[model samples]
Target: MRISKRNLILGIIAIILIIIISILLIKQFSKDEKPDIKVDEKKQDTLIYNTNVEGIANINNIYIYGMHLNLSGEVNTTSDISSIELVLFNKSDKKRYNLEYEYIDNKVKFYLSNKINEGIYLDEILKGEYQVLLKITSSDEVIRYYSLNNNTAYSYMDYYTITRNGKNNYIEISTLSTQMVIRVTEKTLPKDVYDITIDPGHGGDDPGAVKNDIYESYINLEVALKLKKELENLGLKVKITRTGDYNPGNIAGISPYGKGGRVAIGYETKSKLFLSVHSNNLPLYPQNNGVEIYTSTNNNKQLASLIASNIVKETKINYSSKKQDKVMNGVYVRNFTTSEINTFKREAKENNYKFYETINTKTQYYYVIRETGGIITGAYVDGRNKDYSANLYYNSNIGLDGYLIEMGYITNSNDLKILLNKKNQYAIAIKNAVKEYLNITN
Candidate 1:
């Protein structure tokens, strides 16, 4: 078969073109068959980079609680680290943050603040879960990623745990049984142990005052628990004397460290302020009702007044003011024989007690007032005579302020109604008073 040279050349070119198209079709088919091939290629790239890199950075024991983030671990590299920074992502809001850091002892601590940027505060960050990228800049940059949302176990880290030391709660992370503590706060916490001590009066065997099936001990504990929660929410550390129905032991003639017994707990916890919640009782006069606050001394009269005023204003309950001495002048004592009078007087002198047959008495004479230590009120003696003095001046000598709140008279039906029905309102009132007293803006 004789053919032209041009025809032969055209046939060769067509064959070459068909071969190229077939190769393209085979490659497209392979791609369709293995969709994950691209991912494998990317992983290969990462593996190669990691092997070539001499220095590696690691994030161990990452902890996020409240507004604080703690990162601990070592970055091993030949090159010195020039800078270290964090990139935080709010998964819910899709907002991102870039935080600079200074490392100490192979650990970095970051505080999230709105002052850092708009809506980047701890409260806002705590509103949702976040993911973080820790970037370490040396001769080359190394990134270690972590997530606050996941429970997935990683090789070098254990799940976080929470614990409380006295009043402050801490979120802790550990690696190989070594723990790193992360303190959560809106602002830097005070170095002092705690801001307030809430003493729930008359616990365990001592059920304070009991009337109409209402236990004052129960009421005191309930109110104290609520107050603790409220103050903690405000970022204040608060301690309670009895988490359950237990006392620290007696004080003086009173059990559980009678009089200033609670002061011992305050001292142990290093509490700055003390509050004893209690229910009042008037067995002689059932008509005596309303709220009364007894300060350990005159110094804390202002704190007492603040609490009293708030309760009265919120609940519309009467404020039971301390009575004046002249108000009870018309009252008289029984005419006793000389022998009987001598016996009573002898006992009174021995106890250094005053026989007051009248209504007027100093509220500060109570043991809780005299003994509760810390920044508290002074002992108040109603009379000038030392023999008849009721005040022990226990708290006053130390310049600590303590207050006993007589929430309401459990003996009076009217007061009982408010105490039982409006218990939460009373708590709120007390919380407001505490906020004002502490000068807390939030």
Candidate 2:
């Protein structure tokens, strides 16, 4: 109890030194127990839209749901955004829509709800060959443009038209969305004799060559129907322009006269013969009785001659004289003559006789022949014209020998009877003529 002050002071000092050591030890242990925060490697997030390079997105990883459209992408930004707005437009009607965008963890999505116009969406639109404008912008004025690839789906409307120039045929197509026009052209031929185009002289307000109770249009159609059946039996194709005794109207660019108002049928045939069935009517004497055959005055004159000769041989009908004539009617005949004949005459002068000639001892204007530029032959304008004259026209026009066989005259009682008789000698002759024209040796 009687301790010295110095010793007490030493004891206090020792205690203070022990406390300091303990504090230092605790501090060291605390430093060792703490865990370290690892640094994350920087990686770029990718944003892709419909597998297209040009999609609108500022940040990656967002959710967007929309009607008519869908989007997908990834986001790397830490910015907090509730939604993005997408604008869609209808290219055809120029209509627009504001689509709502949704955001999820690192993903954005949107939907387009506008009803697509049918007229603008063609069946081929899904092919993605159309041009579209994509605009992406934020409220802060940041804008971007993207040209979508052929992956986008679309709806469109298509319109088409068909036309012919010479042997060349053209088909035109138009689109309402882009207002673009496309054209396709190809060559075509007539189908068959059954599918033959029988142009009734006139009807539906235009009565052609009326004589008593007989109308040329009615006669022409009747004969054509009979002839169609005959040709069909012969295993030949036939098509009639006029099914009944009526006329639809002047075909596109034809005339009202018996010459202009005739009908034509196109064949998908390899043969180049065009048979125009008709009844002959004259201005002076209504007593003409015989069958007449007309052929193109153009390159098909030979074919025409063959047709005429066969018809004559089979029907035993008299042929009219062969003469140079001007064509004034029948679009196909006139066109064939003009285009084909003009070219033929220039190429083969020795075969010029193959062309059809007019019987007008006065003017050399054979309306059909002249207009067609093809050879015309078969039935003559006058009784004096030989039946062989018709053959000459066919020979000249087609170069393959053909003819225009006028069945018989409606004005002549005997001729009319022959035309109406199914088993008449003339009918047999006509059938034989077609066989001969085709050159079927059997």
Candidate 3:
């Protein structure tokens, strides 16, 4: 207890040193505290961004040169998005078009400039699928991606149902191009319609079918003239392929054989129908006489059949004798070759095989049923497998209902007499058939 002053100071210094060591240890442990590692759990378990597209779109009318696509869609984001970009992929060429747009009012309108040289033709652009991809970035380092599968640009006109997982949404959009097809009633006398093209078949060197001295072409012209008179009386516009008993060259200036023959009549004008009149001659031995109607490959077969049936019914001709056949006659009639026939057969076989692959059935070979109009040849699928191979020629362009009427046989003397008489019962029968087919009451 009785210590010196120096000893007391040393003890106090030792105690101070001990206190400093403890404070240092406490600070070292405090540095290792990990700062509580506070983690704020996200309110939503999964951040999702739902996207939708809308509009009427058609690919056919789209011109790619200097053409831009306008994209507008609504996005529902679970969290605030920092940035968003739309990715458009052209499936045809495997090319991508990226467009960036700022978020506004929970929606975005994006425009992709077509100024870049893609070296893609407008026709090729119409043939491929287009995909729309949406990428969204959020503040929480979470990224959500959404994609829409739009194969054809023309499908934009219809409502698209998008189901993500189990959730359902709708999208409507339109492409820049669209194609429209208009058809008119056939076999009926032309009503007070505006545009019409009357085609008298087998002109010039192509005299269609001949029988004895009475050429099929001559009879065709006579009936066509009568039809023209009736059509003109109805206050309708009409263009005749031939007016008199002469060759196509005789039309002087307005005919196709003239200098401007390449220019197709009624092509620029909105023609509703093309009626080609002709008289068919069967084999001289059989003496088969009846009315037969033919339509272009791309024309509506149902309508053609209706007109043909009405003609047969009105004339009281033997339905059994008349070939109620759907033939690809239009294509073959133009020019028939062995190569073309083989190609057609091969395509038909492939289509048939594809169709039966999914189902169990045998394919049948029918000539007329297999051929489509030159334009619509691509749209024709083998009725067996539904596989598309070639398109019809007529379906490829803006087309109208075309009719080829075989009035009577010129080979038979009895048939010749009926056709020559202007007031013959055959003419009355034809008039009644026209009335029924056109649905004309008067």
Which candidate gets the maximum TM-score versus the true structure?
1
Q: What is the number of backbone collisions in each predicted candidate, taken in the order shown?
A: 18, 124, 38
TM-score to true structure, per model: 0.45, 0.35, 0.42
**What is the Cα-based TM-score of model 1?**
0.45
Candidate 2 per-residue lDDT over residues 1-442, each given as its tens digit: 6879999999999999999999999998777655321111111001111123244333221111000122222323333443333322222313233445556666544333222111121112222122233344555555443332222121221221111122323223323332222223343433321212333345555566566776767665665566667666665544554676466435443432223232112211212233555566564655666555554433323334554455456555555332224232111132233555455455445543443344323221333232211222222222222332222222122111123445556666665555455334544455565556444433
C-alpha lDDT of all candidate models, in order: 0.52, 0.38, 0.42
Top-lDDT structure, candidate number:
1
Residues 191-302 of candidate 1 have per-residue lDDT tens digits of 5355577888887667878896788888888888988887777777777877777654432244433234465565444454678888888877778777777653224144
Error of 2 at 156 (Å): 30
Better of 1 and 3 by lDDT: 1
Q: Per-residue alpha-carbon lDDT of model 3 for 307-423, expressed as tens digits?
A: 456445544443324443435221111223446546666775865543222111111121122121112211133343211222222132333334556665666556556566642
lDDT of 3 at 368: 21
Rank ordering of all candidates by TM-score, starting from the highest? 1, 3, 2
lDDT of 2: 0.38
lDDT: which is higher, 1 or 2?
1
Count of backbone collisions within predicted model 2: 124
Rank by lDDT, descending? 1, 3, 2
Error of 3 at 152 (Å): 8.6
Candidate 3 deviation (Cα RMSD):
27.9
